[model samples]
Every structure is written in structure tokens, then in C-alpha cells.
Target: MKDAKNVTITDSEWMVMRAIWTIGHATSRELIDAMNELEGWSASTTKTLLHRLIQKQAVAQHGGSRPFTYKPVVGEKESMAAAADDLFDHMCAMRAGSTIAGVIQSRELSRADIANLQAILAEKAKTAPEEVQCNCLPGDQTC
Candidate 1:
């Protein structure tokens, strides 16, 4: 399986990548035609993005020929997950403990969200010793 990189792409690139992910392997012309309505992007713009994607190793091309077929090197799900994680990590590092505290203190959550979060915490609290991978720092007491 291909490892997903924490690669950040522009909004335009994300639009194209999402479409390509949904559309499967395609040629530049096919991608441009399919995305034109959504992005109002010209064929040349699409070609440019394909070029950048290839350079980033996120997209691979058919043996360099006219109307070459291009496919994503990373799976859509993995890429999406990695991007979300990167975003969360950035936000956490920026806000420090306040980010987590805010989530814990929020009282306006929907019933479903609160219930699900409670269930997750309950499950974590009951985790057996053998299944635990403690990350408690020095001087920090074990749960």
C-alpha cells in the first residue's frame, strides 16, 4: 500500500484531485472536460496542475505519450485522512492545551455527538493493561 504524505494542495488542485479520485485514471483532456463546469478552468490550467501533481509524485502518468493517462499515487481515503490529521495537529500546536480544553468544556454539542464522545471515553477508560500503549511523560501518573 502507498503511504499517504502530508502534502498540502491548493483549493483548485484539491478540486481536480477529488474529481480524478472519483473519475479514476484519465487523460488531461478528459479531466479538463469533466472539471471545466465545476472550476471553469481551461484545458491548459488542468494540464499545468497535472504537471505539478506528477512532480510532487502524487500523480503518475502513462509512459509519456499524447493524451497520457494519469492516476493518483495515493488513495483518496488515505490522503483525506492524512490531510485532516495534519490540520488538527497544526491547530493543536497553535492553541496548546486550550484547544483540548475548549472541546472538553463545550456544552452546545448535539446529543449524538455528546453521546458518541462519552462512549469513546468510556471505552478508553476500560481498556485493559495489555492493550494499552501509554504515552504518559515522566512525573505524570498512570491512569
Candidate 2:
């Protein structure tokens, strides 16, 4: 897959990706079965989504048999982090902390998830500069 900001995955595509990510590698038949069990998607529907994913370079196909196996070309963490960065960039810098706090309050985070977030924050704190610079161009409204 391309950089997280450039990767535009639909909700349906995310479902198929999650299945492949969880399963490591899977045949089209296996993908259909897993997606059907997970999202009640029909085989034809799953196949179509799989094809789209391949075209997007989000998935890689392998095996020389009748039913080719597929695996994710992009890692889940990379995708999520890129998407989160894209989202965070849209908000005002001054409200970033409050926005993140609001998100934390809204979600039911697991203990592990909380721990991971804490660890990431701690690491960032250690290396964070005194001031962050804005790289926006003259006509960019996002800044």
C-alpha cells in the first residue's frame, strides 16, 4: 500500500483486510468463508472486494495453485497510524490535546490498548522538541 495519507480504504475494504491480517495468508475461498462468518458477506462480494484490494496494492497474491493465497502488503499499525495522522492534521493545533482527550473519553479502551497509548506517549515525550513547526504552505487552509 501507499503512504497512510494516500491510502483510502472503504469500510468494506477494511473488513476484508482485517480478515486477511488476522489469518496471515488465505485463499479466495478461505477469505469468503472468513468474511461471511465475520460480516455475512456473500462469496461474490468478498471476491470483488479482494480484487479491489489487489488493484490498490493493499494485498499481495501468491501460490501457483487453483486457489491463490493472499496476504496484506501493508501492515495494520502502519495503516492506522497514517490514517490517524491524516485525521489529526485536520484539527487546530491548540485543540489537539483536548481532541485526543475527548476521543479517549468516548472510546471503551482495553487495558492493553491504554498501556500501549501510555507507552507511545511516554516515548514521544522523551524526544519531543520545545516547539513544533508548521510546514503548511501559503495557501493551505489546513494549517
Among the numbered candidates, top TM-score falls to 2
Q: Pick the candidate with the highest lDDT.
A: 2
Count clashing residue pairs in model 1.
Answer: 0
Pairs with steric clashes in candidate 1 = none
- Model 2, position 17, has a per-residue lDDT of 89
Model 1, residue 51: displacement in angstroms?
0.6
Candidate 1, after superposition: displacement of residue 62 in Å?
0.8
- Model 1 spans > 4 angstroms off: 93-143
Residue-level lDDT of model 2, residues 26-100, one tens digit each, is 999999998899889899999999999889888988988777999898888888887788778876665577789
lDDT of each: 0.74, 0.84
How many residue-pair clashes does candidate 2 contain? 0
* Clash count for each candidate, listed in order shown: 0, 0
| Model 1 lDDT per residue over 51-142, tens place | 88777777888856797888888788888888767766554233434555585797577889889988986896786353433234344434
Question: When superposed on Cα atoms, how far off is each prediction in RMSD?
Answer: 6.7, 3.8
TM-scores, one per candidate: 0.65, 0.75
Q: What is the lDDT of residue 47 in candidate 2?
A: 94
Report the CA-based lDDT of candidate 1 relative to the real structure: 0.74
